[model samples]
Target: MQIRDLPYPDPGVPDARSGPRFLLWLGRNQLGGQLRSLAWGLLHFGSIAGLPYMVGVAVEAVLDRSGGRLALAGALIVLLGIAIALGDTMLHRTAVTNWITAAARVQQLLARKTAALGSALTRRVAAGEVVAVSTGDVEKIGWFVEALSRFAAAALTVVLVCVGLLVYQPALGVIVALGIPVLALAVLPLLPRATRRADHQREKAGRATELASDTVAGLRVLRGIGGEELFLDRYRTASQEVRTAAVRSARMWAVISAIQVLMPGLLLIAVVWQGVHLAREGRVTVGELVTVYSAIMILNYPLRHFEEIAMAYSFSRPSAKRAARVLSLQRTAESTVSRSRDGSERGEAMAPVMAQPPADDSLPPTGDLYDPATGLLAPAGRLTAVVCGDPDEAGRLAERLGGHPAFDDAVDMPSVRLGDIPLDDLPLAIARTAVLVQDKDPVLLSGTLRELLDVPASGAVNPEEALDAAQCSDVLDALTQASAGDDPMTAHLTERGRSLSGGQRQRLALARSLVTDPEALVLDEPTSAVDSHTEARIADGIRHLREGRTTVVLTSSPLLLDRAERVVFLADGEVAAVGAHRELVHTEPRYRAVVTRETDAERVVDRDTDFLTELDIEETA
Candidate 1:
């Protein structure tokens, strides 16, 4: 079947509920497959029950001195064997089908939830947790769901077998019937402990996965700072912790398995001993005793399923909880009112539309992008630079401008309006379209240079133009250097852009954002990776390419600020000062200090007054 046609079972129900109730919800949705599986299981088990009776008849006929009846009984036994074989094959086929379908359903649900959460997912849930839920949790959940029908059919077979035994011989039948409940109920106490251990193991696994993801994402940075070995050691430690948890979980399951096997063996021994006594007393015939013994032996299949159901439930419950948590993440809020022909909200008539206005008018006029929380306004159409001494405040401002949920009023945060518009009222699509924030480490998806530059909402800007704008001409040359005669335009990028250098990947990401040509582009130190020459070129190219568009550059780089129409120095996340680059250099001491550090010559000169004096004396001579 096609992947798109796969079923998606919801994992979120109520928290205060039993596992069976949750299972019932899944079963009800997939009744046809479950019923078919159930039918096959019953048929197979019924045939198994018939075997003991056929054997008992053969024994009776051989002992009775009736040759014709013995032949007839032998023939019936052969027919029953054929029936058992046919039923067993069909049972296996149906059960496996149920398992595959259940696995598909869980996978579909996970994929759907991931899509719904979008970028918010990574912010809310750890990347490792998400990876664990999709790969490991889906399988465990499917195992439990598929096991339910088989368990039900096995239970029914046990009941029918017990009833048949009672009709054949009441005294021995009662003993076999009494043992069924004991075998099933014995493992219930062990379930809670097993489940707890499984939960712990799953949690540890997720943490380990998250640690690995973080380490891999920042591998370049770690290596640059000579901390690759340190991070690798940390990951190894985390992996060992996961291994320990897994072993602890395995130990609990081992105990439960021993009990399942040992209890059934003891039950078989008891039934056999009781049957011999009955035969000695001459109260039961030999054939009837054999039938009772055979039925008790057959009880093993159903009892084994009881153990499996317990194990499946123990593993699946936590997985379901994790899937539910992902699904429950809310999307960004939008207005209920429809948009007008002019792209304005139909319900409200507050602001007049301007001529040749910015692509998205949801952002206020006068170019004043305000965040009420910190009382900051980034005036429109001007090159506004945010200089935060605190890195976290800069991050917060960048998130707000990008309309991330943490700063967005609609997503469990305080109602801090942006300009006069309620941040939530503005359409999420429009808000995102208006402002594009490029993080320091933006993701570079696997694609050719041409494909990377053609990002979301980007018009047909020539690949050459975008590459030049982001100062990626050298990066393109570097790709050719790495591989002889490799087509820069058609070269295939590996997953997560692993094939490229860190600086190359970063520049490509910047080019992609520039290609989008958004009304307001928010770049957070977009040139932190590239050389000084490339950085200056990018700064110049950005000013030229986005001459009319509102661009906000978050950097302490004086080379970039030198081209800005206005620079807003951010102190403790507030707009400390707003003016031209040269003006900030002369007026703000903090700005001067920050910009002075950008030049290595100034740092060396500041360190040595003798060097400065020698330069002045040589000029005078």
Candidate 2:
């Protein structure tokens, strides 16, 4: 494929067998670019090698007073010079293209993998490590892939030039051949130490990065607790460790580099000394002596590629391994969507994973969702409120209801089903359309206000309607004002709506979720950031917007619970009581204690205030 055709329609399924294997896979996929680069490299280096021969011929022509031969040799030298210029230029062009495309391909694969894994990826891998992989690690892997063709061309040129010298002069060829091998193999012993130091440096930097990310994410909280200095000091310590490790790695590579230069310089000195001695003894002509010496000097350039090849591979090997590890993380079967869902396998005409289409043509099953583990049946076409004693249990239940487990494998647990069909049995896309879960913390994507609320949905609700239902008029005004009186729908937002307040961000997220208008919508403390009055409004809005649909809200707030058609009181993650919110409050003391959280002293204080207010009213009368 041409460079212009890149960002391949499909990056192709990665063969993530191991680090070395992954490198091999990347190389094979870009074989066309690699070959073109190699061919150009050959022409360039070949010209440099041929220059010495031409110089020798010109020298001989002048010595013999052969004017015609001299002119021919001079003209040939100019042609080779032009070839050298063109070849080097084109080689560099192709090599860079190879690097960019390889990195792009790997990035696409990681993106697809991230999309599939969602929040589970961050749980399995660190946020900083993922950042490092996509940035520095990707570049290193691409560098090695680009380095391969140049090294091959250099090695081949050395071999062909050596053969040419052997035919021209045996005595000098033997010494040159023996020394080149020594120069190539001399630094093998130091590579392992260099690799270890580099690995240490990379690990230190990743930790520092992760720590910084965490600090920034909770910067407001850190400032409140007066811990900004504490984190900064820790980051400083990590940065110092990274610096020290980097210096150690550089020192090891310095020794290897010194060896590389020292051996070649020693070889050059030897070839020159021998050539001068031979010319003095009348053993060889002046032209031949000049050719041999110049050849040794030119060989110096190609020999450095050996060092480059070693260094590039050393850096890229670990990077490839990290990339492979991330790619190896598989989504659990229930959460895994087929490759075809992303168009990754469309070009290959690949068969479906199941051979036959899923039953129901992958459409969402229609019915009430039942969780056997908790004995919670959210009946079809009603609003169900679940009051859990523990907030953490409530969050996990919200995830499980949508076939996603917050902390464990959903496949290993009892499968949540809809209308007699296990959610696990349906494709992830289908299941997601069937049940949409909005957790306590929902993120808002950055884009225009219109784009932010535009998502795949039943198309029954529009962005404006969803915003109105979520009581986001203030939010719309603020965004429009921020955009300098642009259309409210055209107002832009920042990442996670950082410029917006917590309550505002929450309302916007709720609005976006509402736009989808799913068959079943599950919310966990979605109104926690808003005040009671606003929460009451939002609760009523949800009740009206989700009428004739399956809506499940996991919260204990009186404003929200009082409006539920049915309330399930959960203690120890199981149904302890099921009735109307008000009925359960009087009948089940445990439920009342969990929801009200009022102690005996607090209850007495409330009674005293009520009596005083009554006495004042009576005095006024």
Considering summed lDDT, which 10 consecutive residues are worst modelled in model 2? 337-346
Query: Model 2 lDDT vs. the true structure?
Result: 0.84
Off by over 4 Å in 1: 1-4, 7-28, 64-124, 221-237, 331-370, 375-383, 407-435, 547-550, 589-621
Model 2 misplaced stretches (Cα beyond 4 Å): 333-362, 372-375, 569-577, 586-590, 598-621
lDDT of 2 at 494: 92
Best by lDDT: 2
Model 1 vs. true fold: TM = 0.80
- Clashes within 3 Å, all models in order: 1, 0
How many angstroms is residue 321 displaced in model 1 relative to the true structure, after the best TM-score fit? 2.8
In the range 25-82, model 1's lDDT, one tens digit per residue, is 6667668878887898887787888888877887888789778888887888788778
